[model samples]
Target: MRAARLRRGLAMALTACSIVVTVAAAARSTVPGTPVPPRLPAMRAETLPARYAANHRFITESEHAARALGDEGRAGVLARLARGDRHFLSFSPRGDGQVVEVLGDLAHADRIAVVVPGSDTTVDTFDELGTVYASLNGGARSLHAEMRKLQPDRKTAVVAWYGYPAPRTMSRDIVTTDRALDGGRRLAGLVGDLRRVNAAAPVAVLCHSYGSVVCATALRRMDAPAESSLSDVVLFGSPGTGVRSRAELRTRVPVWAGRGATDWIEGVPHVSLDLLGAQIGFGTDPVAAPFGARLFPAGAGSHSDYLRPGGLPLRNIALIALGRGSEVSDD
Candidate 1:
């Protein structure tokens, strides 16, 4: 009886070993013959940045942008931007995974408006904002579409510049601004590139939310003799542009500021130093501030509604783009 029990135990051990071997073989077979897919050659292990120890963060951010735009199939826009392809001229990368978009005509365009977006903005957000909020594509597509509708013969284009790493939340405004300086430098480079392409093109930068910070940093870095013909810099839903007052921004260019009555950003503190030793200051309310900027009327809603389709702020932007500044009416 004892001999029979020993034989049975040996048989069970052999079965268990066989099962383990089979599972190991199956796991090996599941791996691709080429571990890296041919399509995503740039995303291979060796090519990834050493700093991105959390490589998954890049993938997550890309997927978030893609899903936001409602285009699950083309979720690789941010990834592609990292690879330096301009297929998404509406979105291009400056560094890391930050993407920007340049719209309108590249040559001989009468007016150019660069729309800098804020937080959580990735290449994918462009599509999502366009798809979900048809009015909010920074009013970019709609603004351009309306321009075409109003005057088919006119030349105009809107650039969606997301050249900086935007804060995921308002709490990170300071952190976001720090990174935006780098983006601002890149934008200044783009300005040079644009001038080289067309010296006669009039340029304007429309900064929204935290984008105002990026524009402020860019303008600050410009020397007085620089040929950057940035005619107008408009800020909407701005927390602060790191200047005590609009005049302290030190640009010969006109600075435009506006905010909706219900906008939460109005509550943010607007305090910064000026070129002079004096403390140039902005108020809790941008509309009430002494900045030389022309305050336009923003309708009801939080900060995100300025560029909504059919909104007053967007119409004002369209007016600015068309060079009809006097036509802009206050809300």
Candidate 2:
């Protein structure tokens, strides 16, 4: 029985790699007049409880670009953003897709939650009405709303980080840590920027699916000050964090993991291997005993169900983000 399960796991991982290689090769053949990636400007310095004029300028430009292009769906989201006190850390209409939007006032916020999205998520999908990845925008809004409901006086913010290009499919891109490594560096830079923005404010990162791998990498590389201020990290519906144990994540802060009973990620093999000179397939299930993370109560729901309105997972995640750890429920 053990051998059979192992074989099945190995087959799944290999199949994912082979399919990804083919897709990657085909993608390399570029078509004529394919739009080139956007060139972003240099980042400007901004103080904590401070604002960057450069970022705001980029936001205005991006909003104009969306509206000028006659993309109603994209324009609508930008229109809403224009009316709000939305503080944009960065924005670029690159083919790679990049955006860092903050809901609530980060300048005055005492607590912040950063949501790192998984595969198939992109700046374009933020307003894509019907897909699960649309939550790339909605999920943060739900979390921010739930956090406020607990105590309206508490100042909190939710950041939807679409800075890294997510893998288009769940095949080899996920099995490898290459993208996660890039994402990790971006995450680290964000954390560093946040520290400069408000070092005293507590920050929590909510990582989903492949995003968990990105979070783990960031944790391992982030400077001590940035790590110190990041109070918690919640991994929900995570396939694997690419680390064998939470301790391997190299942060003293609290690391939490949760999964709904119906989450399909439970079926994925929790194993790792080295293939073609790259470490593939993260090992050890995060919610399992050996992964060494605090388990939280996540009600029965499938992948993408964690941040749904009124879900148990949303509640607990908010508590963690709010630094009200005592209020979180154990599974």
Candidate 3:
């Protein structure tokens, strides 16, 4: 009886969301930034510096395209990305855009954190707010800085991986697992590549909101589990992970969940049901005991505050990345 009621509620919500999605898609039909043309080929370089140089050239070309389209704001963003200081493993100006930016030395880092952002992420809003350690790159820098402070002797790196076309916040796509599935396939490939590049480094994945769903799928699809480089998987302010429990993830590493006291996602319904021949909603609140994930303190942070500088959540995430999970504070 209770399950039936939950299904009915979810169906209603999905119906409403579908209508909104139609309107939003129509509105975006003539959007200014439709992916720039003349896509470049992927770099075949094995060295990190060569890969960075090739990606920088792509960014520069993308900036020119943005300027030609009269999008100064986007061009400006791309300009900064093409700078000599920035190191990108991948860059694409197609669709909503994608980037895999690395902070710190990737080749020699013994500790690495891969950050997967939530919905509404794109190249345009990549550095949104521009606050210290708030934007995508800033947050990566924050985590890297925190990890360095925790273990100055250990080499650390953070990858801000926006490798998929994240759905808009109000889109129906955000509510479903379609994007997450695609994102997971890509994420799984990335993890495989990372393992090949640095087989011994302890890697941690920090998934935020919808990214949790993506991370879960990646874990499910990954092969060669015994050689996995993943040391931890941390989900913060997540809606759901599309799984009932952490055991379903089949991960040997610790699965951690955390949510700030003031996070709005706490109110999202933690239920999944079949509706319209599709999976509606992600299942189980990850932080709940039923999910069987180790709970970590996130302090009083909102949905976007988990990676903010000086936040308790950021500190804990850093600790997890550094393989110092025991030092993570309960308070």
Give the best candidate by lDDT: 3
Is 2 or 3 the stronger prediction by TM-score?
3
Runs of candidate 1 with Cα error greater than 4 angstroms are 1-96, 129-131, 134-138, 170-176, 223-228, 271-285
Off by over 4 Å in 2: 20-85, 129-134
The alpha-carbon lDDT assigned to residue 274 of candidate 2 equals 74
Candidate 2 lDDT tens digits, 9-110: 678768877773454454345433333433444433334123434555555566677667675665565565454356666665544356777888776788
Q: By TM-score, how accurate is candidate 3?
A: 0.90
lDDT of 3 at 86: 91
In order, candidate lDDTs are 0.57, 0.78, 0.81
Candidate 3 yields a Cα-based lDDT of 0.81
Model 3 lDDT per residue over 14-47, tens place:
7646664553344344435444433334432256
Candidate 2 or 1, higher TM-score: 2
Cα miss at 166, model 1 (Å)? Answer: 1.6
Winning model by TM-score: 3
Clashing pairs in 1: 69-128, 90-101, 91-100, 91-101, 92-100, 104-157, 135-309, 244-280
Q: Which rank order by TM-score, best down to worst?
A: 3, 2, 1
